[model samples]
Target: MEQTSLNLVAIAVFVMTLSALLSPALNISPFIPAGTTLGILTLATLDSVSWGGRGLTIFLDLFATPQQRQRVIHHEAGHFLAAYCLGIPITSYTLSAWEAFKQGQPGLGGVQFDLTLLSDTKTIQKTPLIIERTLTVLMAGIAAEMMIYDNVEGGEEDKKNLRAIMRIMGISNSLYQQKESWALLQAKNLIIRNQTAYDALIEMMEKRASVEACQSLIQEKINQIEVMT
Candidate 1:
């Protein structure tokens, strides 16, 4: 997500230079844009080839605005809530790339599920339910973004994860699209139906609540909703 943002910055710089937007009023050093572009591209390449972009990821987080951090929190909360509903146990979550580095995810930050179950999930005929749940969990973040923004700005990583898992299950490329579409709908419905619980989860996460506390609070909120309904 941060990488995408940075790449856009580089592109914007080049565009501004070509259009001579920085000619009269912004009479700054020409070396500024050139050096900035070069530096950004270099960091992007190095970050990609090493530590999964952890260095740049952490650097970006330092200057991240409150809204940017909230987006991260909301995105991770979607994953957390989906995993809980699907009975897929999550071990932890990290909202920023730095915390993700501490959690060993580096450039990737989100809910970490106990994915050991995936090793046992084969391409057998009887495992369709398991497969569906896993796909929905994978699409949850994208779904949340869609629900809130009416447009998803992230989820390339989610798509890659889904594709990799599908390949592991011996699913064909053609069916992958159909499966992803279905899972996205399922994830949207899951988050929308449990709005109160989802909002509570986001709040807990924003407060930097522990995994245990978040889960417990979710259970409490869900129980109340269930009883009231």
Candidate 2:
């Protein structure tokens, strides 16, 4: 997927460059933006593509402003915070789809927990508690976006991930909707409950804290929350 996406991006860049070169002869200024739009549109239309998937995400990342970068940091921090509160050990996190692509990870960006811990205990089963915690983590990014922007758009990948997990558990559509809503509410409540710690973690993450630094920050915040409650 990564190679295929890299190839597609290379082709798109080539097309856009060719269009830019020809724009002078055609006396068209819109040609460059037009070609870029066309490239993005083509990538968007592919059935294999998800919102933050490799092909078009790199384009989005290229044009993302500083505010957008901060938003991604906050979004990822939400996942890390929620997981930490739930006792999930985060192994690493990324703030850019491009970074995730380089790491051979799916989705735009995310906090990766150490799921390998489960392997030592038992076969990881899709029990109710697991599903609930998973849903909360899945919706935490959306919750963060909604809190800051009054809207959310980056959770498409999260929703897709949730659906795939639910499918494995044989969850019904109605139950899925209920669980999603419940989990989102839980995530929002947790964020609200731990707002100070969450904000501190976001600041730490925005500064490009390393994995060990992030884990330390996470633990500190979680400990504070525990003391408070």
Compared with the true structure, the alpha-carbon lDDT of candidate 1 equals 0.81
Candidate 2 whole-model C-alpha lDDT, 0 to 1: 0.75
Tens digits of per-residue lDDT, candidate 1, 22-125, equal: 65567876676677677777767766666566777677678878877777777778888998989888899888877888878856578888877567645333
Checking candidate 1 for backbone clashes, the offending pairs are: none
> How many pairs collide in each candidate, listed in order?
0, 0
TM-score of 2: 0.72
Report every candidate's CA lDDT: 0.81, 0.75
Candidate 2 stretches greater than 4 Å from native: 1-56, 116-126, 225-229
Per-residue CA lDDT of model 2 for 1-229, tens digit only, reads 4444555556677777777788889887955667675765476557245544466666657777898888888888889888888876677787877878877776465788776534432343635576568778889999998998898867877888777767666678878788778888999998998888789889888776887787687678778778878
